[model samples]
Target chain A: MQFVLKSVLISLVLVGAAFADGIKPEALSKDGAVTRDRHLTEIRDIMRGGRGGYIDFGFYYTPSREQLPLESQYGEHDGFAFNHHFAGFGAGEVARGRHMGALLWFDRSGWDGEDFFLFPHYNDFSLQRSVVTWGLTFTDARMDWTIAAGMQHQNLEHRGKIYPYEVDSLAYSWAHLRFSKLSAQANFYRTDWRLFRFSLDLESRAIYGGKKSGPLTYLPNVSLAMYNADEESDIDSMRITWEQNLYDQRLYAEVAIDLNDTWFHSAALKFYPDPSRMIGFEATCLNRVRMKQLSDDLVEEESDLLWGGAIDLLFARFAYNAAYDYENFFGAKGTFLVEFKFNLATIDGWLFNRGAARSAPMETDVVKQFDKNTKQSEITPMGSGSGAPKTIEAKGIRYEKAQPTATTEGGN
Target chain B: MKGTMKKISVLTVLLACCLTLSGCLTHWFVDSTTRLQIENRSSKTVVEIDILSEEDSDYKVWIRDTIRTGEKSRVYEEDWVGTFTMRVRTVGSDFDIENLKLDGGSEYMVLSDSTDGSLHYEFK
Candidate 1:
């Protein structure tokens, strides 16, 4: 284990050395406010992807659950009230030409209080995932049709306790098929009748030696296959989504059905109060369909409902969620989350462009013209000599008049 | 236009019904990675290094094994973030550094031996 960890550490150093570019010196020249904001924006870009590519960093915590009576046959296991501490980083980028993209994420969840727990019984784990996508976009004057094929590889260092029957570790790879269509009407923002944008995504977990660890197993359906301990692979899922936007508001609906014998439906309404999308709010509801095994011989289908709301402010977001007659694996009811994210690619283009403008020096000609106009405007009159109309031809200049004039030209 | 609006309204209601009728269990959260490098300059070999969170002192983000004297440790990345402090333990002495800033990116620290048997440190 030490050797493996050392190897990973060496790889990280090599990777970091190769991409040693950190914050630009100019950005750090000030009190580092630019550096901080840029970091936040870069993380945001990773989540939503506006700046082509980004390296993301974030932290989240989920409160511990109340103690519950254990009925395991082994012994009375200490269900110590331990909170979940998670930290991870992901980097991804899609080419500007929409031809290819790749993403990688490393996530680690540590049980903070269980410091000295013995391994084999209680172990440490990490997950690394890599995905590559190839896409093609067909666009005409009125609409865009996009199709993509992708593959994702997932590696788990140590299998969690949830999957008890699993061996020491697991690795699997899968394929994805995605298609979408955006009508010209949707882009026009017309109040009149128009077709909603539509998209569909499908994943076949059965491909590429699905769930590679255990013996080869086959199942009948995706739903039932998800829960079968004997059949670890050969599962699939499909999702369909429809979206519509009207000026500052958007409506989205989606349904996903998994071969693991589960289904999910969700709908969301989002409002962008400002044109920049720096501040926005969204209300969403989700419903899940599950195939639960109630007894050794009996199985049943169950449904759960949940609703949530989220608010995004510049570089941060807060969300609150509540489940209806539903309990999580830990029996928690509601969750509150705080996140720092900004997608310079989504709707913060203007803001980031403004930042770019601030960092980038002005052209010499523009600066000279600006200085000349400012110096002359202080002494110049609205109408020079005899109240005739005046035309100031200074580029990039704005004139504020005290009174209305007959005619004005040149200056903007 | 009115008919289209009516259809959309009905579709929206149907979508809501779908959400109200179906379900699963999920919790969404994002975790961050933090990188740190330590250079041990003390004459004594260091045993363990503990990284404690500022918000929750009891929380241990990482417990590193050992750093021999005059040895520089490689950059270590952990699934952790937030403001933190460090405690370095040697044979019979321990050193504590408060308010250590690790900007969620990369940080380097150099620990040196002092004439009076204390530890001096600086961040790079």
Candidate 2:
């Protein structure tokens, strides 16, 4: 056994040296220009550096609506509701060339009083939701591999003004291989928790054909997760989801089922006109039956089906999104979101241009001309004398140019 | 039983010797044949170096003068790894190679970053 171990160590050193020798010293440059293929560079850039932090604020408003049939006599008055959300995201690479980075994210959202009252009286309390997430990612360009591990905390308002928090830990990794006319990717993800649930998911993708024709397609994905309230309790159940994309890039569908004394079926469809715009609709039906452990006698329960739709639009420097969701047991809820984004450096350039225009000095030129027909005093004809005022044409001129335009330099 | 044990021990010793020889031979061939070529074409002066380790760590870099031709000399030395950058600026017309070197086992070379011509280096 010792001999085998020694041999393995020696082999590792040899392989390391071989790889090191492959590094072309001449290829090093300080200009930050990597002499790799376009696709490879794209992947490398995504994993290379990390961003500091970002502040995001969002507002959503949904009008009151109702669910019909089962609760025929129930009607909720039309009311306006709003939510404000704030988040900060940051990440950094700790190890050199190993492609390792850590990410931290925090988000908080609150609902307005008017929106809170739209629900049942017992549920009429202001809501505050917050989440904190931390993750570490490992990336390798040569091997085309990336791995990430993280944990998250989610808090929601409960029972009037009380807040309850749920914690979850997750680990995920993805590997992508490139070929001449095709590519494949494998992804593994797992999340474990006590308050919420624990789940494991594995996904694979084989992409063939070109961007336009060969059918940009996908198939159902599989996942197995356990849900329970607490330890030592037999209230555990398994949940599964299957999804697929069809009809070029125009449609997407998914179905989910849980096997814990409850039957749930869900279907969704997405319509995408182009790369930047999409509309989607989804519905879910759920029925809960009494389990032997909970109650010896089986009883039939009411079935609930919920439906919703959403629209998303991506613009040059802004995005617009709207969604409407309705649950049979609750009232209808909707959200409208608008986001405006611009690079900090670009804004600085705009401010500088404005300042330059205000600080510029204005000057005008006046020219005296001699026209023989319009001269008030005796004037020489063309080429008749040398001392006469040179014939000149008066033209208006501005000393300053207009504000600096957005020059198309260094554009992607 | 005693005879069989003796025979097995002898065979094992012989096999170990043969495997060791083969491993050394493979390492020799790999090291001798591995070569990396770099072409520098930039306006700034650049020092090219290789990080020859699987471990992610910094390599020292510097310059030292090895050969002198008239007023010119070749410099080779190890440079500080943290302060080192891929590109460096040249002050005069002459390319002073003796002023830069890398302190470790890795191979490195300095060249003018111009597109007019190509610079080549051979490692043995």
Candidate 3:
């Protein structure tokens, strides 16, 4: 029943607007100025210091389509302005491996669907989510790491008037769902490219761990997860990924295979024209193969493919995608996103060269000068009384010239 | 199903091969010798210079006699390899360079006296 509802809702939303493309399911940890991959950003924090803080606001729009899931109804489409707002702050010194950060994010999106089974019925559903997160980082002997945790609250509700469909089972006013979850994640970065990560969803008791290590040229990271610990089941999912960054981090390529009951894989490539990553271009391809049990002894298999690309400007981004769904839910879609970013400050990096200090060096210049003066006094003693030759002590290293007696030259 | 299973098998084998290769490439490829030259640029003479290795906690005396002003100490090749702490004593003040990593190359440590009667040192 839950799977049927989800499928219907997806199809309902598809009819009204082009589905947003290139937005991963993972919750973003920052204000979107940094890279979308949170793991890479964390590594950058330890390797190149951190971005202090920023705020971002984004708007999304899509065009309406005439085709509906029931084939007899039509849906209206509208764009949402300021659909997402995010603010975050992070700062630390990489050498000391000390960092702290916080984030607050809010997102809202709505879709409209209308159908005519017995009578014309209108359905308006809106999804609103709020998330708050905090993280702290510290250093170890060989690795620098951090731990972050967040809470997400979601509300899915039907808004505005719902026309009575004359059937008790088809009433839409009571349709609503509220979900809340707490999640925690930890990351350990040993070097620029070597890392380990762990995440846990507290409400669902789902846990995942991943590790990546190797040379910089080719690194493989793998993650494994179990959705529920109390249930009797094998591992529910495993993710195998290979990521590479080249040309001074201007080009990035990634291939990921996610295995569950179904087989899913995605390959994505991104290029950044500037160092700040305010402008970029990216493309992605996704494929999924699903197996379903039709009966006790029968099974069915289906495959879906999606390919998309996006161009991100400094303040706006445009994305388009073509999809082939086995159930023919989504065909093609375009999404327009406008974002504003404000950077509060930047974290300054400092060097750490502290250690146990030994004692100072021996034999100073004062001691050497004292010894030389004592030796000079012992080598020559001055005679006393009038008319006697006077002796002068030299303060500097250079000695005075000797004076010849005039009486000795006359006698010769 | 058969094709998916075959792809998973091939990727697993490739991951294992990469990890094994990483283990084999752990050792460094080159052997290097570091030559250090101490230059006394201060007005006062530097009497004694010492290099202490953090790994062994042993102090190797590099310069015992007085290094006169504007004079450069002979090239002192580091016999041991590791992070080292260096100490220099002049007539007026003492200078220190702590937790320094000297890799295969030539390094220079210049000791100079500041106007405020303090010692300044820099490694290049």
Instruction: Indicate which candidate wins on lDDT.
Output: 3
Q: Which 10 successive residues of model 3 chain A have the least lDDT summed?
A: A169-178
All candidates: TM-score: 0.36, 0.35, 0.38
In terms of TM-score, the best-performing candidate is 3
Residue range B1-124, candidate 2, lDDT tens digits = 9999999999999656434421223223222111222333334343334322222243222332222211222333221211112222233332322222222233433243344543222332
Using DockQ as the measure, name the better of candidate 1 and candidate 3: 1
Looking at model 3, residue A231 earns an lDDT score of 31
- The CAPRI category of model 1 is incorrect
All candidates' lDDT scores?
0.37, 0.31, 0.40
Residue A187 in model 2: lDDT? 27
The C-alpha stretches of model 1 lying farther than 4 A from their native spots are A1-51, A63-103, A109-151, A160-162, A166-236, A250-264, A275-277, A322-332, A340-343, A346-412, B1-124
lDDT of 2 by residue, A21-60 (tens): 1111111110011111111212222222122222333333
For A169-206, candidate 1 gives per-residue lDDT tens digits of: 33322222222211111110122211112222111111
CA error at residue B16 for candidate 2, angstroms: 79
Q: Rank the candidates by lDDT, best first.
A: 3, 1, 2
Deviation of model 1 at A118, angstroms: 19
Over the stretch A1-412, how does candidate 3's per-residue lDDT look in tens digits? 9999999866755642444421211111111211122322332222222223444444333222122111101112221111333444445445544445554444432222221111111222111222222333332212323333333333333332222221111101100011121112322112111112232111110011111222332322223322221133444345555545544344667666665554457777878774335566778777756466788899898877667766777555555451211111122233332223222223232111010001112355468789988886563456545557776766669777776778567765
